[model samples]
Target: MERLSLNQITTDNWNMREAVEGCARASIPWIALWRHKVQQAGLAESKRYVRDAGLRVSSLCRGGMFPAATKSERQARIDDNRRAVEEAAELGTDVLVLVCGPAPDRNIDDARKMVEEGIEQLVPYAVSCGVRLGIEPLHPMYAAERSVINTLSQASDIAERYAANQVGVVVDVFHVWWDPDLYRQIARANGRILGFHVSDWIVPTPDLLMGRGMMGDGVIDIRRIRKAVDSAGYTGPIEVEIFNRSIWDAPGDEVLALMKERYTQHV
Candidate 1:
């Protein structure tokens, strides 16, 4: 049987409880929880609802954003990630995804260094909590705004620098589809592949940051990437993580239903 999961931000307006119930009703198998919504919906109760609904948690939404201007700020980011790891453990989630932080002042190299240092600092703590950290490579367009880890090679290098099996990368196809190095890097990441997130890229992407089409609605060759990951031995959930306001504004259940259908037919 195939497994399914969702990123909480896809249903931006839905509270965690609402999202869980909606997915459960749609018979989707899992969810990737966001920090704010976890707190808003109360972690304990959220876990209960998910378990009660017999839903699996593929991974937790995040624990990165490691770059900062000062020592205090950087330390604060590490502390926050520690908390995120603990939260993932509490929820019985196997992976905690990391959106490796962006530059504080547009210095990409500096941000990358900070991401390395921060992950090194947090790994021991995360290990203690029994939570695996999955670094995510955002699109190059996000190099300045969201993450410094923008390539599979870069992310794999960092993961190898720390723990081979304990730390890995979450490959979101929408972010890495244009990379000429994706196939080779995915091969390199063989055993270290942590999670796989899916969504399509619209040609005239309305919003550079948020416009994402459904699996079969745009130009992404999702099955090719899926085949690559599967060949590389990644038997993880293909998590749907679209961040479109137009989709969010619709009935949450409708979106989830479509997500399940597409996961079966297209993705």
Candidate 2:
């Protein structure tokens, strides 16, 4: 439980201040924030709340959606990611998790190229802000609407293009646990892993985006993956990032208490 960090989305009912205070009350020590909540609370005010609560921000939830039909649209995404980088810096977190978006059209290959180019464009600004872009590949099922990059190997391919400090991969067990090449890719990621997220994959998934289960509630072998990440030399926070509606509907305190229990027993 020492390295546990609650990704705020797990307790979706809590606002920014409440989440920060919740973390403090639970003695969680670290938080992973989402951009919308931060914006709703006012970035400066949110930063102040976390700082005052003596909590550390693990990584900003997201900063990438680089695929668009037009060059202008894509550039707008780049600009928004720049703002995300600034937000991450001000919030005292150095990792900006990137959920590389789906293809704008059917040309997934072109969309992927755009993803790489977008990272290429954003790397300099991220580096300037003392932030690292952590590309989080979504599950292959989300290829149509969520993220085109669908594996740790793909994320690593992109991260290797830039300096390890400027770009890295985020491993979320819910997304990568089924990969046959998971262990090998994790070994290859070594020093370039920026974040690690934990969530079980329900066997009969009810939703593609929000079906994630709390640890030990589903079929994932989370501890094995956690061991692999540790072996890869990433001694960082293990963020519990469940997106299940049922989990979100539960009381925040109950969720936190259970999260701690699961972290001890499962992760």
Candidate 3:
């Protein structure tokens, strides 16, 4: 579990301070941050606090909801993403995970186009800011409300259009395990893979978005995928990003412990 990283959302109830301290006490050297939690602790101070706690920021939580009804609203979201880029700079994390939200005004094709175009605009700026944008392909369950980019192939399609240092595909197991071409696509990513997230999806998920299982608690072969990622030349952090409500409701310290144990034994 040395490469294990605890994503803040796994214990969403804890404030940024507790999350940092929890990782420190558990000896977990890395963590992934959510922007909202960072704002609650204040951006500059968040950076100082994480550094003081001796933790590395694996990736910043989010920065994409590109489809909007009007041009102004789209521009507003783009502006917000720019701020996300700046926040990532302050937090000392190069990768910013993006959940390209579904669009209300158009079909999947158009919504995806918006995502591609949106990231294209941010790529140059992200390069300048020294941040890499990670395009996360959420499960197809999120096709209508959460994200239009639902496959690693689609994300790779976009990432192939930009430099890997500026834009890369995020391999979150829960989202891509069902793809028949997952391993092939992982190989195709080669050096373009950014952050790798580990989590299991229950056989019959109670909640599409929030009901994620702990490692080894579900059917996914976590280590197999990790090996595929490793084989693809991605030596970065393998973050555990579980969004289950019960996990979040539990004590943060205990959650961290179990996450580490599961990562050690299962991942």
Candidate 4:
């Protein structure tokens, strides 16, 4: 319970102020914020809400979408990432999760190189702003549209290219639970893990992007994965990041209650 952090996406209907207040009311010590919600609530107000509620900002979701057809477009993404770093700093969190986007064309290899280059460009700014960039690999199902980095090993490979303090990997169970080499890659991450997210991969997955279930309701061995992350020395918040539409449609308080119950039982 102490390590549990409610990610804003887990309560999709709630705005930043409501999410902050909800965390405070639930005695949740930490909250992982999304950039859109922060932008909606106004950054200063969102920061104030978290500070006043005494809830820590676990990590800002996200700051990477590096693939583009033109160099100018890629540079624009880098510029936005710098702004994201500033937002993370203002929100008082050191970690910024990066969901590296898919290929601009069909050349995934080129897109991957672009990802590395973008990270290289952003690292200095992130480091200056006291932020650590967390590269999060999405599930392979999202390879065509969401993210090209689809495996923990790939994410770790990118992170290893930079100083550990400047870049690291974010382990999200919904994305990596299917990998046979997950445990080995997790072990390889070691001190390079910046964040850990927990959500289940439901059997007969309904949607590739929004099929995540509560911790106890799916096929993932979440506790085992949590143990592996713990062993890897990530003592940070275990953020609950679910994208299911049904969960989002439910009442926020009820969703949070169920989340806590499932977290304790399964994760």
Q: Estimate each model's TM-score.
A: 0.97, 0.99, 0.98, 0.99
Model 4 misplaced regions, further than 4 Å: none
lDDT of 3: 0.91
lDDT tens digits by residue: candidate 2, 93-170: 999999999999999999999999999999999899899999998899999998999999999999998899999999
Query: For candidate 3, lDDT tens digit of each residue in 1-267?
Result: 567788989989998999999999999989999999999999988888899999999999899999887788888989999999999988989999999889876577888888888998888889999999999998888899999999999999999988777889999999999999999999999999998999997988888778899998899999999999999999988899998989989988899888988998878
Q: CA shift at 19, candidate 3, in angstroms?
A: 0.1
List per-candidate RMSD values in Å: 1.1, 0.7, 0.9, 0.7
Minimum summed lDDT over a 10-residue window in model 2 is located at: 201-210
Which ranges of candidate 1 are over 4 A from the true structure? none
> Each candidate's lDDT (Cα)?
0.87, 0.94, 0.91, 0.93
- Residues 128-147, candidate 4: write the lDDT tens digits: 99999999999899998989
Which residue ranges in model 3 land beyond 4 Å of their true spot?
A: none
Better of 3 and 4 by TM-score: 4
Clashes of each: 0, 0, 0, 0
The worst-scoring run of ten residues by lDDT in candidate 4 lies at: 16-25
Single out the weakest 10-residue window by summed lDDT for candidate 1. Answer: 1-10
